[model samples]
Target chain A: MRTKRTNWLATCFLIAGSVFLLFPLYMTFMLSIKDNKEIADSVLAFPKVWRWENFITAAEKVNYWQKFKNSSIITVLTVTFTLFTNSFVAYAIKKKFDHKFFKGLYFYFISAMFVPFPIIMLPVVKLTARLGLDNLYGLILLYIVYGLSFNVLLYVGYLRSLPQELDEAAIVDGASVWQTFWKIIFPLLAPINATVAIITTVWAWNDFLLPLIMLDQESQTTLPLAQFIFQSKFGQDTNLAFASYLMAMAPLLIVYILAQKWIISGVTRGAVK
Target chain B: MKKNNFGIYLLLVLPATILFFIFHTIPAVMGIFYSFTDWNGLKPTYKMVGFINYLNVFKDKDVLDAYLFTFKFAILTTVIVNVVSLCIALALNSNIKLKNFFKGLYFMPYILSMLIVAYIFNYFFANFWIDIMGYLGIEKWMVNPLGNEKGAWLAIVFVTVWQSAAFNTVLYLAGLQTISEDLYEASALDGANKWKEFWGITFPMIAPFFTINMVLSLKGFLQVFDQVLALTGGGPFGVTRSIALLIYKNGFSGNEFAYQSANAVIYFVVIVAISLIQLRYLQKREMNL
Candidate 1:
């Protein structure tokens, strides 16, 4: 009887928590479809009109496709480069963990995990501008570089758990180190790669500050940057702002819903490590 | 054979190393170097001021207020998030129906952009919250929280906790799964009450995770930016201005590049110190347990 009561209590608590957690998202969806007069009538009311044109109008106003393209390019390139470069470096460090140089390199990469981004923000901006890297590609390059510490940590830790014998066997089969890693080792890293990719995708897709600082041109803006500037410029249009927000977040929300389990487990796995 | 191995190692690592060096290492070094100088970020030449900027960081009221606000925000969010998430984790770890569904629903907010989340909540505070409060006859909350100095910081904390607690709950859930069910059963058999069981069994088991959540949350919150930027823009008399936002504003807009770099360096030191202290204390407690 006690166990049943407790279970009932837990369920109630969880439902309430979920409502609170999701209220803003619910409101966003509701407001996105409501005109300003309807919004002023009742903030909580379901829209009688269901104005889907809010989304169309928002997309056109923000040049949604262009920003979407920029975001996709940056996120895709950043995730891809991060996976290859960080894993390649981790593999080398794992293979040569016995060497002082490699061990020092490992520590060098890991130490960066402690440094906050703001500390390096100004100088990095200065350097990037000086190097003519103040653009989307530069932002992608920075993500790949900044990702080294955490991604390398994850990869090296996972790599250590896999036996060295696999690499040796591949090498014995006339495979070069590169071939051995790509063929035998990299494939074995599917789980960690998923975790890395999920984490990187969420970060790169949602990040606003890096793009805000790097990409000065209006045409170079990512979805988040564009939405930010849009809201500030069109501060009075709550309905349109919410519509733009909904559209901006729609891709990530769809992806999350589709791969809910993978994302949850991936995030959990990343954190617990 | 050794020479060949060295070549392979270079081949694999040097590209990443060069990128890390150029972007990460050089910038960090430059940040430190410039923190001591009077460089305004535009001029090519400036004299090294030898810790003058760091000295000004202590004397400057805005910088000091930013540190205080940031620390307060970090501490409040860290405690609230950890406690709330731990409770949610405990409830989820109990015998509940639709556990996976609830878990997925709760974790949804975390994947959304912080800027977007902040914007959504900005509207909530400005409109929905006021309406709800008016309906409830709560005159205090009838006005927009983001426009009040005290309410603005609390609102930021509330929103941060809302999104961040989900992630921590997931962490705590992972920790909860590691415990043997037999231990709980044994504790129950010993006539331990729920509170006793939690303190005696669950808390200790999840202490390591408690440490991880606390440290990570504190470190992240100490550098709070996007929420403040999107919601308050460090307004209501700049009471909600975080060190990170202050650094950005001062460095970029205010053109106090060298001074903000110094502040940034100090902020970096504070984060490292706090994290180290938390880890040491928490890990020690874990060991004692």
Candidate 2:
């Protein structure tokens, strides 16, 4: 009876917390469809005339499709390249753990995790300009490289739990090192790969600062950057800004709702490990 | 054969190494090198000015204020986030209906862009809160928190904890699961009350995760930017500026590139030290357990 009572109390607390957590998102959806007079009259009221056209006008104003394409291309390429590069390096380091050079390299890569991005932000901006990479491709390359520390940490830790005999067995079958990694070991890395891919995807997709500084061209704007620019310009149009914000949030929200279980588990695994 | 094997290993690692070197290593080294010089980013020429920039960082009131505000923000957020998330994790760990739904819902904010989340709450504070307060006859509370100096940092903390607690709750839940059910049953058999069971069993079990959350939270909050940028923009007399935002503004906009580089280096050392100290103390406590 006591346990039942406590359980009821806990459930109530959780329900209240959920309401607080979801309030902003609920408001975003509500205000996205609200017109100026309706919003001015009552911020929380149901819209008398839902402005569905707000999304269309906002989309056109922000050039949503172009920015979406930029964001998608950057995120996809960053996740793909991060998985390949970080895991490949981690694999070699794991295999050669007994060697001093490989061990040192492992520490060398992971130590950068302690170095905040601001330390390197200015120089990287200058270097990217110098290298003619101050664009989307440059941002992708930066994500892959910046991600190396954490991704390698995750990969190396995962790799340590697997047996070395898997590699030896493949080598005995007359496979080269690269072939063994690709055909045998790479297939076994599905879980960590998912974790890495999810992390890199979220980061590259949602990042604003890197793109804000690096991409000088207006055409290179990602969704967040475009929303920022849009908000600064059309911020007074409450309905339009909310519409733009909701549109910025929609793709990720859809993806999260669909693959939430995998994403939660993946993120949890990344954090705890 | 040994030399050939070494070559193969090197070849496999070369691509990532080169990229890491160019992007990560070169910039880090250049940042440090530039700290000793007077390069204003746009200038092609610079002269070595030893220790002056670092000294200026000490004398700059804005930098000092930023450090104070950042540390205050980091400490407050870290403590609140850990406490709230741990409670949420505990509640979720108990027998509950729709556990998966709640878990998914809690983590949803974490996956959204911080800038976007901040914007959402900016509107909330600007409009929703004011409207509700006005309806309640609380005229004093109707002012937007973002525009008020004292309330701005608190608003940032609230938004931060709102989003970040989800991630930490997930971690704490992971920690909670590792506590064996048998242990709980055994403790229950001893007539141990819920409080005793928590302090004696649950707390110690999740201490490692507490450490993880605290360190990560502190480190991340110390470098707070996106939320501050979106919500306050370090405004209302620059009271909410974080060290990261200050560094960016100074380096990029103010043309104090080398000076901010020194600030960044100091910031890096402080972070490293804080993390190391937390890990050592927390791990030692875990050892005693």
Candidate 3:
């Protein structure tokens, strides 16, 4: 009976906690639907009227398609470059036990994770301008390099745990090293690659700074930058701003909710392994 | 075959290595190097102005405040994220019916772009929850969590805790799973109470996980930018300026490239020092398993 009481208490605590966590997101949906006057007056009140046009207005104001295109290009480019480099680097490091150079390379890459981005944010922008990489291509290049370590570590761990039987089997069948990796090892890498792609996509899609620095030209700004513009332009119109924000997030929220399971598995597996 | 394998390794690493050298390593090295100079980040002419930049960094009371605030913010977020993560993990780890579904829901924030999460909270903070509080008949406080000083910190912490707790909970869940079920059986057999079982068996088994999650949260929190930008914008007279946001302003907006680099260097050092200490401490406690 005592245990039952404590268990009930625990269940309540857990439920309350989850609800509390969900509250912020729940309120966001509510605020987005309310008009501005109602916002200040009814801070927590139910919407007197759901102005569905707000979303339509937001979509038009932000030129939603172009921003989406920009973000898509950036995300695709980043994920490709990041995965390629991360896998390549991990392959090199995985070959290390007998090779001192490989060991040094591994350490070099691992140490990169320690340096915070704020330190280099200034100088890197300068260098980008100097190097003429201060454009779409430049932004892509920058993310690939800076974001390599964590992804590389992820690949290295997964690769390290891979069995040698596959390699030996391929070799016995007279497959070349390149062939062995591409035709054999790379296929086995699909799951980790998906994980890497998903993680990088989330990071790239949300990235505001690198593009903010590199893509100063109006035509070049990605979705987040465009969202920034929409935000400031419509700042005084809270209802409009909320609408824009909601529109901006709609696709991302959908994609995430859909992929949340695959992502969780990948993240936990990546981290714990 | 062996010689060809070495050549292949070289081939694979080259493209990434070149990019890594250009974008990450050199810039970081130059970030530290240029902090001592008087470069505006654009003009051709520059001079190595020793100690002046660092002196200016220290002299700027705003930067100092940002430092203290960022440190407190990172430390607080890391601690809270871990604690809340542990709690959610324990809850989820229990025999719940809708465990995976709830885990999925909780982790939704972590997967959503920070931009989206920030926007969601930006609205949640200013408008809706307050209304819910009213409906529940406890709307007296009506404080906008993201508005004022205390409230801003609270809001940021709350948002961060909420969003990140799920991520860490997954980590803990994975860790919890890895803890030999036998350990619990052993504890139960020994008449160890639940709390004692947790303290002894559960906590220690997830040693490496603790270290990894701690480091991940530290690095993640230390680089906070989006929430501050979206939610507070360092408003109410600049109280919410994180070190990352501070660096962004100084670098991109403030036109003090060299000075901003100094700020970043200082930020980097603080992060590395803290991480190194935490890693070492965790490593010391971790068992051979």
Candidate 4:
């Protein structure tokens, strides 16, 4: 009898929580299909006419394809740069465990993690302008700066888990430090690499503040900026705005869909560790 | 072989290293320099008035509010998400059917961006749940919690907790699985009730997982920006504003460059300090497994 009551309570809690999670998604879908007139009147009611072309119209208005290309470059390059640097830095620190520089480098990198971006973002923006990198290359450099520390920490944590005998064996076999890292160490570190890449990719892709502040020039705007402009300019028109949002999310949503399993496991594992 | 290999190793790290030195480390050094100066964030032509901006930030009330508000959100969300996730975790730990599907459904929110979630919740407040309430004939409970000051803070806390609880649920569930069944058997033999068994055995076993959850949630809550920006824009009188949003707005949006840098420096110090305190407190209190 107690178990039966417990089951009922579980069902109630599960259903309520599920509804809480799903309500917004369902509303977004509903608003996308509904016109502004319908939305103003009521968002809960079923759409009398589905605006199938809302997405198409938004895509056209926002230059969705162009933004997608920009986002792809940013995410791909940022992930590659971030992961490589983080792992190398991690490897260097790990190697320096017996050397005098270990403590200094470790403290410098860890302390870097606590330096909030606001303190540095302005200086970097000015510095980027000065360096003539006030475009894609500029933004990419900004990503590397902010992204490297966390990646390094993740790599350090991961590298610590690995045995040091691998390095010793490579050193004995005429494999230099670089050869050992690239040929043997990097191959064995695939799972950690995957974790680092996926996390950094999502961070780079979803970032809005950096792009908003840095990519102020319209030609340099990423997808989020493009989507923001679309939504704000025509937010009253539920169809066009919703379409833009859906369009903006499509690439990320699709990519995440493909890697959800790995991401979920990776994220859960990260937390556990 | 040695010369070539050493060169290649450096080459392997060159692209990333150069980017980091230019973008991150250099700017960080410059920020400390700028904080001590009165260079209005943008003007290339300005005097280097030393220590004044930092002095002004110390006297600012809104900056303090931003710090307090951020701490409030972090504490409330951490407590709520952990509790709610623990309950859900326990449910799944039991003989619940459709467990995997339910887990997936719960986790769907985690993948969406905060901007999207914020707007989605705005729609929920203005339209969806109210209609559901109207349909159920309980319209009194449909008041929008995201509008008023205190109520809005609570609503954001709840929303953050709702969106994140599933992931915590997964963590605790994983933690629960690691516990030996023999512990429960031993508890049963001790004439203990289920409640007693859980508190004495179950909770202690998951203490480390609890610490992990606390830290992760604290990080997420403290850095909350997109949702607040999208939903309220820290509106209805800057009541919902967090330190991060305040820093972003002042530093970038308002162009109070020197002032904002000082603000950010203070904000960063508070987060580091509070987290250190929490860590120390938690360390002293955590039950041994």
Candidate 5:
């Protein structure tokens, strides 16, 4: 009887929380299908006529494909380079623990984590502009650089647990240091790599302020930037704006739903550590 | 072999090293240095403005309001997010069916862009919420909260906590899973009620996660920008503005780049001090425990 009561209470809490979590998403979809008249009439009511063309109009109005491509390219490159560079640095730092520079380098990255972006963001933006790096490629480089410290921390912590014998064994078998890392250490660090990859990818994908400042061209605008511009221009058109929002958010939402298990686990583990 | 190893070390480390030097290290040093200057971000010339910007930060009503508002937002968000997430974590941690489903649903918002989330909620606050309340015949329900000064701050807090609680829920759930089931069994055997069992057993064990959630959410809330920008655009007389928004406006939109750098420096120090204090307090608690 006690167990039954606890179960009932837990189920009730779970249902309430789930509704809270899911409401906005449902509303977003609902609003996307309603015209401005329908929205003003009854924003909470179901759409009388599903306006699928709202999406078509929004897509045409904004440079949806261009911005989407820009975001995808930047995210992919940022994640790939972040993983490769940070993992390699982690391997080197871990393998060369006795080396004075590696020890200093390790501590340097760790301390760097404490320096929040705003502290450095202004100067870095100015400096990057001076270097003619105020573009998408430069933005990727900034992401890679800025992304390194935290990821290196994650990788270093993970690498510490892996047996040092792996490196020694590879080196003894005539593998170079580079080969040992790329061929052996890198593969062994896949789990933590997934965590870093997902976290960094999400950050680089959702990042707005940097792109807003640096990516000045229409061609360079990311999806979020484009959405911000679109809303400011035509935000009164609720149907079109929501449709554009859905278009901006759907790809990531779909990917997350399909790969939720891995994403959730990665995020939880990443945070707890 | 030694020569090749040295080359490999440089190759592996230099990219991150050089980039960090340019991007992270130099800018950090320069942020403080520039705070002492009058570089307006456009001209190549400026004079050293000693302590003027810092003085202005304190004297300026808007900047002080930004700080106060941010503190209120961060403190409230930290408390609400942790409590809500902890409750959800406790419920989900129980022997509930569809546990994974609920967890997934809760964390769904964390992955979506804050801009997108704010935009969606902006629509609801501007239109749907008012319409629903009017339909229910509630007096003055037509007034949008995001359009009011005080209410807009609440709207920002709500959206922030809503997105963040999911992540904290995941963290707390992970922390809860670490507590041994045997401890709970023993508590139940001692005739401890649910409240006692939770306060005695579950809460203590998850205290570290509580600290983590508090510090992280506080830090994130202090830097709140994308959501505020999208939802209110610092509207209703900038009552919803954050320090980060102030930094962005002063640095980019206005010509007070160096002054904003001063603001950023102060913001950075405050964050570091607060985080360090929290960590020290939590660590001391752990020791006491």
Candidate 6:
């Protein structure tokens, strides 16, 4: 009886918490549909005349498709390259975990995690300019390097839990190191790979500063940067600005709604590690 | 075969190592070296100026303001985020139905870009909240906090805590799961109440995660950039500037490349020192627990 009452109370508390959490997003959606004039009158009211055209206007004004493409290409490339490179690095280190060189290398990479981005961002910008990598591909390369240690650590943790005898079986079957890794070990890392990929995609998609510094050309602006510039341009038009913000947020929001399970689990796993 | 294995190791590891070295390692070394020089971004010729930039960092009022604001903001957000998330985690870990739904709802904002979330909240602060508060006769909320120097820092902290509570909740939830239910049952049989049960069973068991969440949030909060940019842009005479924003403004816009590099190095040392101390303190607590 007492437990039931407490559960009911907890449910109410959670409902209230969820409402507070969802309040801003709900406001965003509401404001997106209302024209600027109505925004001042009814902060929480449904629009009498929904300005659905605001989205179209914002989309056209921002060249949303181009920016979306830039965001997509950078995020996809970063996730792909980060996953591939970090896995290899982790696998190599795992294979030779006892070797003095590999041990030192592992420690070196782990220590780098403590070095925050601002510490290195200035020199990185200068170096990018000198190398002529101040573009989308360069942004992708930087993400891979920045993401290495954390993903590699995740891979190493997962690798340790696997039975070493599985790899030995492949080795005894005359499998080359490459063949063994590709055929046996890589396939086993599917779960951790998903976790790494999802987390990296979210990060690279949302990143602003690196893209701001590196991608100097207007044509290469990512969605967040484009939204920033667009908002700055359309500062007074609340409806249009909200519309642009909605458009900037829609892709990830939709993905979260559809794949919340995968995302939540992935985030939980990543954070716990 | 041994030589082939060695070759495989080199081939597998060399790409990431080299890339990380060029981008991450070298830049860190250059950041330290450039701190002692007056190398502006556009300058072709510059000379070293031994600790002058560091001394200036102390003298510069704006830089000092940024540091003070960042440290204050970081401390406040870290404490609030941990408390809110732990409470949510505890509530969700209870026998509530639809807990998954609530968890998902809470974490929804976390997946969206901070830039976007900050912009959304920007509308609320600038217009919506003021109008509503005006109607309700709440005079204080009628003013946009982002336009006020003192209030802007609080606004940033509020948004940060709101977005991050979900993440730390998930972390604490994961930690909560690792704790066996038997301990709670034993405590309950001993006539322990909910508060006692939590203090005795829940808090100590999750000490490691507490440490992790604390350090991660502190590090992240100290380097806050996106939220400030989207919300205030260091407005109201730059009262709410974080160290990262200050570095960017000085290095790129003001052309104080080497000066900002020195500031960054100082900022970096502070971060490393704080992290080391935090880890030592928390880890010792975990061990003691």
Model 4 interface CAPRI class: acceptable
TM-score of chain B of 4: 0.87
Off by over 4 Å in 5: A1-6, A98-100, B1-7, B131-142
> All predictions: root-mean-square deviation over Cα?
1.9, 1.9, 3.1, 3.6, 2.4, 1.8
| Candidates, ranked, lDDT | 2, 1, 6, 5, 3, 4
Please provide, for model 5 over B89-191, each residue's C-alpha lDDT reduced to its tens digit, 9 standing for 90 to 100.
8888888878778777878877788998898888778766776778999856567999987688888889888888888988998898888878977888899
**Least well predicted 10-residue stretch by lDDT in candidate 3 chain A:** A1-10
lDDT tens readout by residue for model 2, B174-256:
89988888888888888999999999999999989888888888988988998999999998899999999998898999989
Candidate 3: TM of chain A? 0.88
| lDDT digits (tens) for residues B1-289 of candidate 1 | 2224877787779888988998998898999999999999888799998988988889999999998899999999999999999999988888888988998998887888999999988888886778789899999878899999778999999999888888899999999988998898888888999999899999999999999888889989998999999989999999999999998998998979999999999988988998999999999999998
Q: Could you arrange the candidates by DockQ from highest to lowest?
A: 1, 6, 2, 5, 3, 4
lDDT tens digits by residue: candidate 6, A132-152: 999999999999888887887
The predicted structure with the larger TM-score, 1 or 3, is 1
Which CAPRI category fits model 5?
Answer: medium
- CA lDDT of each candidate? 0.89, 0.89, 0.77, 0.73, 0.84, 0.87
- Measured against the native two-chain assembly using Cα atoms, what DockQ does each of the candidate structures obtain, in the order listed? 0.65, 0.60, 0.50, 0.41, 0.59, 0.64
Interface RMSD of 6: 2.5
Candidate 6 per-residue lDDT, tens place, B1-289, comes to 2333766787778878988899999999999999999999788988999999999998999999999999999999999999999988888888888877887887787778888888888877886667777899999767889998768999999989888787899889889988987787778789988888788889999998999999989998999999999989988789988999999988988989999999999998999999999999999988887
Task: Give candidate 6's error at residue B53 in angstroms.
Answer: 1.2
- The TM-score measured for candidate 3 stands at 0.91
The CAPRI category of model 2 is medium
Residue B255 error for model 3, in Å? 3.4
Over 4 Å off in model 3, which ranges? A1-11, A34-50, A172-174, B1-4, B128-147
Worst 10 residues of 4 chain B by lDDT: B1-10
Instruction: Flag the better candidate by lDDT, 2 or 4.
Output: 2
Backbone clash pairs for candidate 4 read none
Estimate the TM-score of every prediction: 0.96, 0.97, 0.91, 0.89, 0.94, 0.96
